[model samples]
Target: MLGGGGLVAANVYASATEGGWGGQSGPDATGQVKSAGMATIDCPDVGSRLTNVPDGARADVDRALAELDRQTASAYQQLQASAQALSADPHAADDSVMNPLKDKRSATIERIAVAIDRVGDRPEGLESLAACALLPGQEATGGVTGGTGQPTATASASPGGGQGQGGAGQAGAGQGGNGPVASDYADITAVQPNAPQPAQQADASRGSFTSDCGVNANGLRNSDNVIVAPGVSNGAHHFHDYVGNQSNNAFASDDDLAKADTSCVDKGDRSTYYWPVLRLQNGKQERDAGAPGGGTEGNAGQIVTPKQVTLTFVGNPRSKVTGMPRLLRIITGDAKAFVNGPANANASWSCTGYEDRQLKDKYPLCPSGSDVVRTFHFQSCWDGRNTDSANHRTHVAFEGPDGSCPEGFRAIPQLVQRIVYDVPAPSVEDGGRTVPLFAVDSFPEQLHKPVTDHGDFINVFDESLMRQMVDCINSGRTCGAGGDGGASASPSAGTGTGSGATAEPTAGASGTPAPSASNPSELPRTDATTTPAHTTKHSAPGEQDGRGEQGTDDTGRRTKQGGRSGHGAQATPAGAGTSHSAAPSASQAGEIGQAAQSPEPGSGRTTPPPAQSEPQAVHGGLAETGANLWPAGLGTLLALSGLVMLIRAKRLRY
Candidate 1:
């Protein structure tokens, strides 16, 4: 019985260690022995003979066993702490401290089982069994003995035998014979879910886009280029290299172009070459390209002279010794009507007018039946790289027509015009400046409005409303109230009647004198003791007699006050005999009364009560109470039962 009990205890210990019950001491308390039929147990007692027998091993085992108890206690404390934290704030259930405590509790339970197993057949083993009963898998198993008819006898082929006879012999020696049996056990204690670990703070300085490329602005590198070939032309082929290079020439540097090269070749030839006219800095024509005296035949009433011309070379030729020269070919008649001869029939073309009008519609004399009157102009350079490989000649033929220069009048060239080239200064407006263009149609409607200032547009309406409300409130008038209550009229004019009852001067008020108009019925009522009616009359001095007929009271009563009394007995006072006596008008009285009473709307007056102050009683509250206590309570009961069995095992001699 004692041997079986010891084996059960060892099994419990192994389970506890393997399943994380062996607490936070680091090394597991149950020393795992490699031998299939044996276990190495360590405890404080038993001399060297048992110590080396894989049963008794070291003095520290007692300390470990005691620490196991401490860990178990800690586990309980952590559970209580977790419960309290969760109760304080459900959000606190995710706190960090709860995880380690939970793990330690599980580890401790395993260690306790191992410690009990180590003290097999000894007094300490009994205490270990007691602790194991509180943990998982600590159930006792029936004992096996030999044929001697005594429970301590060793097993044999015979039903019963003496000690040291068979498998029963090892059992009688208080060792786990054929190893410990596996069994299910109660958990040491239930642990809360592992708390979330703190997120690792990221290093802000590293891993940034600007760190890779020095270009900090949200734009592509300036060195990137976009090459655009010719679209169309009218007379002889005319090309304007905006970047300063000639046709079929490479740019100075990769960055010289704005984007990738686009070839319109192979697509059927375009009809026009759109070009913007170069506006002169002084806004005046500087040059003219026309025939000398009278206009040439077929070109009547045409201004052939170019008032101003600016040509920008977009590319560089290989040789610097004698740099590429400008090539200009001018045709006299409508250049657009001239068809491409066999040599250049397949070349692509397009035309654009100087003022952005469609080239096809603006010029009427061009080919392809369009209004664009085109003339051919061709220019090219040869550094041994010629477009016509078959023809070894360095000179390349170019076609130009009026369609190429939609705005400029076409004129016949007296001779082939070839001018040497130099790097022209950048147009004053374009130098060292960059402008970004976006698809205007893609912008949101709110952003497209013509606002005086972007910031003001965003703030105006809301700001105005707030300012008005504040002014009204500070003026001693509440909002949502209909009209102004009876506040002070003015310090400039005295409290009595006449034209003095104007509102107090606002900040934006004009300083103009009040007009001498009288509306006696509209005047507000004052205390009865004050003057009844004092009319403010304006006139040139001595124009009227001091006591003249006009000055006499209309009611025929002599003036007793500083001014003459009003016509008839004192006119019935304004707002007399009415519940709205506070003001001359009932509307004004109602506004004042409302302002004095109710609070503003939407003031959070109907907020719901907090849940904490009134704890909701959950359904099946009794079941919840039992469920919460089940783990710890059941663990204790099992551990205590195992202890009793261990005690009995020690008392029985095998």
Candidate 2:
């Protein structure tokens, strides 16, 4: 049964015990081996039966049970690993001979059954091991029918490990004489089509830009600006599918990044677009996961070739937007989305050719000429405050069904990611498969589950390309003539060439506005003014802002966006400081000067401190202005006005 056999806690990276405070079992809870339910890894739940056996008998039982414990944990590791694969992309459980889900489960049950025979006469160690064969609650238990929550077994079975006396004989897959294994996802249909099924809805006022980022078939990339995760040991821990900026990494500065090679049709667009590496886990474990002293998690599988990768941003039709600055990381779809409720989960899985078939855990076998796709809708309405949140969420939220945001939440360009995989058409032999689906490289503790498989993006786009994306979505035109934001109709990468991959770039791709001129009727205004109010600093695309590339200061050469704050290494600490400091050069000074006076697009009024990044106490002795000097003109006006008033009343006052 697919019961919750989670080996670790929710925060796998936090502590050795994972996340729980549950203490170890002792003479008190004699029979029960409970966990803190918070993810404590140090619990002796398997051998509670050996608690009180006689001293002479205890040592042998302990030795035999120790080996049993080792075997069970090993099986559990493989089970969790396979489960993680299935979770990320449900179709991984194909019924092929290479790796079948049922075979794994069957082997695990047999291993425990053999271990129990070793315990022989020791009833304590023998009894508890039987219970675990159930995988706790009912789910992955498969063939064993009837009854629920942990399997009930009889220790009365013979010492030799033959089929146990009565009916519990199915314990060993060896005894059942079953012809073939089965799948947990076999003939299961649960996910429903979204209310609107993500129909074609384009806010003419909210423009959209769709970039056809090239399809990459193999190998992990480590570029200048495409840093996937920083704290993960300086980024050697994982690898993602990068397509936009050639120079993308954790430490790549925006300036060096802008000139890198781009896989997108728009040669100038330097935005680094990436997601988890979708692996084709056959037998070969391709990419390295930084082993020995660096990192333990590595991915060994064939990389799936994407037929089409469309990157798009559609602004809420009702808001006026300008441009997003550098170093913005956006995430959508919860890797833990298997849990119910939209409050924290939004992972959607569907086949490109089959909209009616939506499953939370599995994808349908695509017919010939079709592919698998994962669609993600990022929170569009922002707080007009922080660029990044504590959990990398929070600061932004999804729109209501009516496409409106709650008060205080201003709308930004809604970002949408669609990656299409050229998976092979399902064959009859591919049913009941397990652990064959691929995912991007990540830590092992994450279980590589699709529910925890989320996408990440850092906007390193050249000023013109980013501005075009922001403006297109803001203006409400659906760009991307060569591609639709969703339904990918492009040629396959490194393989087939069916969907017109050879077509030239569209006019929008040429940096020209699309549908805005023909249809400009905007959506209902959310506020008194249609223009969105920004709370962070806005910079023209490519221009060096407070936090991007650094400039030479009076003191010495220092980092521009991320300064050497002696506080702590964590960027964007709560109530601490932002990634940038006071102005370092004339361009940044002019940014404060000129942008402060310009209004947000469509506002029709002078701007009020064009939205700045998350608010942090300004550090560094440098001032926003060139020298922080008062305007001489304003000072002279104040002096003249006071002198005029004095002269007019001087004679009469005396």
Candidate 3:
């Protein structure tokens, strides 16, 4: 079913017997409909279904789809704003929100059909999908209640309508009156270990390559989604944490990214890696507290800097890997999974000690000594033709259940991302009365659900580095650790074929340098330079960096990192700019909120500081700085169900 269309159909059938959309059966308690509550708009996901869009028409279609999303988002916000009117008269929902939204979508959908028809065949029945339904946020759709027996925050009132205030300096509830209730998390210790071992053949390429990009301590963030909604400012409703490329923004071109400076110790890697920022709902506001994609977009609270971010690339279990084409873009999870269904959901959540028990739908609740972990295993099988597809996904896919590529597809080195955080465990049983909750930023209608957590990547590895990565995996050589190229490890190191549980690719094995002082080897270092090649500006505690906070300048260019720009609104251009610019500050850059770039390096270019070793996670305390070994074949075929709880481990002081 499309966007829970079946639920809407059920409501339609029930209306005849129940009364109306808000009608109720004879009630023993109240005469009102027992199901009356907050609702969000749900419609068919047009972009996901368009697999055959012509290249000539792709741009037009993408813009149309993005407009459709914007329309839905605006309608949902209006729905929230009119909560009182809707509760007073259910017809208000149709008159003010749903009907108007349908008209807008119909016109947009027609444009899409026409664009495709000009180059290919016109799609029929798209008009039927224009209409949407206001499904109750707590009903038929997966639960949003936090186990407090209260309905989802969206069903309550307008934003800030009695939602709890943030902890300190922050403005409102960390959830921005949207979600992340008690029901979103589960205890990791109570979860049964269900991680299945990948069936590797004798010919499996068991080697792994790791790239140590820092934890984004520089605080680079944005709301632009270059892959899905390029050129549109605030394309992603929520904020995203960025590392790897310093020149990335909605308007950044492939050449711009290729020419950009990298945060990786190996300068050859200019790839861009980003994901929705995880925020501590404790209400400590960062600089974007009042900016678009921040507090204004329902993403509130202090953004938690990742304590450690591990980027690893491993080989296929069934075949030799090939070098990924440069500039290949991959999106690993579904940002709209909460409403789009679990069909393409790929989020993996767990604690360090309990990684064998991964969860997808719920956030994991870890015990006192562990830290929260989020992992993303990108789709590894490429069609061997297109680097990207119309849907931004059809060009790449996960291996079959048998761990083999589909016909015409070839296995490339799979990128496995592991991010760890030190957060106090929420008291879910008591509804976070003691500890504040944490959640990933999400589209407003998604209600900040855990299932919506996702990541994005764009491979910019130079030809030489990419070749080395491919060779390392295919030859089963554990290269890149200890700053060594083509380094060989014990044959059985990463094979997961030995006798003990340690044989199953734990964090301190193989060529992956352990967090030991005596052995200071790190992962994927082509050079041993300890100092960063360039300097980057970072905001002081409580200060804001306008250029990095998703705001654009007068011409709508997102400035590089530097001082916060004047209060510039997020740009919402229909098409991306053809060139990149570092405009002056908002005060000087005209009425539009274009921002100035961060101060450039001596070379007159923007580049990130070099990567440094991070604190590795120990069972009970913080270990010294070293590369943490992730499983060679992680997140492949991993199932998602429960959520995770963040526990405060010993802090890893810089």
Best by lDDT: 3
Instruction: Give candidate 2's TM-score.
Output: 0.45
State the displacement of the C-alpha of residue 101, model 2, in Å, after optimal TM-score superposition: 30
Which run of 10 residues does model 2 get worst, by summed lDDT?
A: 173-182
Kindly list the per-residue Cα lDDT of model 2 for residues 543-572, writing each as its tens digit.
Answer: 465434534333121223433211101122
**Candidate 3 local lDDT, residue 84:** 58
Model 2 spans with C-alpha error above 4 angstroms: 1-192, 195-206, 222-231, 234-238, 254-256, 287-298, 317-322, 336-343, 367-369, 425-442, 480-654
* Ten residues in sequence with the least summed lDDT for candidate 1: 207-216
TM-score of 3: 0.67
Residue-level lDDT of model 3, residues 309-424, one tens digit each, is: 67778888878888999889999889989779988888788765556567788887654334577888889999988888878899999988777998899999888777766554
Backbone steric clashes in candidate 1, count:
96
**Model 3: ten consecutive residues of lowest lDDT:** 495-504
- Each model's lDDT comes to 0.20, 0.37, 0.61
| Whole-structure CA lDDT of model 3 | 0.61
Give one digit per residue, the lDDT tens place, for model 1 in 1-654: 444455555566455544221111111123211111111111211111122212242223433333433333333323223433433453332243334444544454455446546755332432332221111111112121111111111212111111121111121111101111110000001111111212212211111000000000111101101111111111111111111121122122222221222111101111111121111111111111121111110011111111111111111111111122222211111111111112321111111111111111111111110111122122323332222211112133221221121122211111111111111111111110110000000001011001100000000112333333334333434221112332211112111111111211111101111121243322322232333233223332223435232322222212223222121112222322211111011111122102122212222111111011111244226876576555445555566777788787788955
